[model samples]
Target: MLGLKQSDLASKAMITRSVLLGLEQPGRKHPDQLALFQLRDALIRDGLTFVDATEAAGEGVRWAKPSGKVWVDCLKDARAMLGYSLDELSEKSGVGRYVIARLEKTDRKRINEEAARRLRDVLFDNGVVILAEEADIGAGVRLRSRVRPAK
Candidate 1:
């Protein structure tokens, strides 16, 4: 719609043409964060508000999840918005790369409280909000940082 063909837009957005076509058609699944943001920016440049474009695009989707895993997702979003990388975050936060990798993966079970606190601080310093909630687990300790933003 920005004087560019669907294929051109897809290429510019670094997504496949099928994704672009799917976004154009109604009732299709919503795009991921990167794609959604790229489309949003393009639409805004063409005089459409981001909220309106997002609403129009996701008209039929009953629920849309936030991007990223709690720790990983928050870090990714903050890094992207703040123009940093995993290595930079590790260096700045003093969290090991292996720990960061494990946290981003699905197998993560436990994270030290200190590490979690440090991560929260790093993300907050970058202007990202970190919300940690606890859920009950039997009669023992509760689970922490269960739900996170999508990547």
Candidate 2:
């Protein structure tokens, strides 16, 4: 989901690929807590979320939502958080201004993958990191360390 290879993830997590693979393999012993937490946090930083099983759904991985709110709000909040006006976001994302306007105004508007990908890339570039919902925590966006909130 994060489009990361084993080596890439291992490097990001500061762990050996073999150790990461061991953790993935069934029947193998779990890695040490520190190693596991390191890997988890690393993945989280890159927009991967681990979900526990609930009565309705089995345990699985979910990509962070592209934006913070459900639909229109998501786009607006993401843009606001990055201090990007619709025009700036449109320019940065290579998406048309009209499309972004429609996205922010229309409720439950569905966007094609390409457009979504464009916006997502722009958001990430500006430090708006989306996180998937967990058992008790809801999905949201977080700024990277270097990103300051807009005044």
Candidate 3:
């Protein structure tokens, strides 16, 4: 439940209330990608395990099933675990608020290589371990990483 109201969940999930209501009802079609992911994370925080579609549909679709927790989720959790806010992270990392927000939200489909490297360095400096790997893209390049906070 994450202590969030239905309307709040809908707003955060970027879907309409009716859509969220329908998703909550039995036998209704599941929410789309964004909403589903958001709802799954919220549920996970509340100790609920979500059966990811990518896992169930394995190999049929080329979807990257989120392996364990996502890097962004790790970042958010690490920050919270350290009792740091976005503003504090921004100041500590010397990364701008907008840039940090963009990274956290994954607003862009791709991030600049230099930016990604700098982000990796900053996170590492903050006791967060991050490993980046280059992924094959048809034409463009992609970077994938696993992140966790150092204990």
Q: Say which candidate scores most in lDDT.
A: 2
Tell me how many clashing residue pairs each candidate has.
Answer: 6, 1, 0
Clashing pairs in 3: none
Give the Å error, residue 114, model 2: 1.3
Residue 49's C-alpha lDDT in candidate 1? 32
- Which 10 consecutive positions of candidate 3 have the poorest summed lDDT? 136-145
> Residue-wise lDDT of candidate 1 within 47-130, one digit each (tens)?
323211132121111002232334433444344434567788789899886676666544567756677678667766655443
Question: Candidate 1: lDDT of 60?
Answer: 11
Clashing pairs in 2: 69-74
- Model 2 C-alpha lDDT per residue in residues 41-118, reported as the tens digit of each score: 998898756655445433434455443434233556567666798889988888998888776664544766577667
Question: What lDDT does model 3 reach?
Answer: 0.49
Candidate 1 vs 3: which has more TM-score: 1
Q: Which stretches of candidate 2 lie over 4 Å from their true place?
A: 1-73, 146-151
Off by over 4 Å in 3: 1-73, 131-151
Better of 1 and 2 by lDDT: 2
**Global CA lDDT of candidate 2, please?**
0.66
TM-score of 1: 0.41
Relative to the unseen true structure, what is the Cα RMSD of model 3? 12.4
Worst 10 residues of 2 by lDDT: 65-74
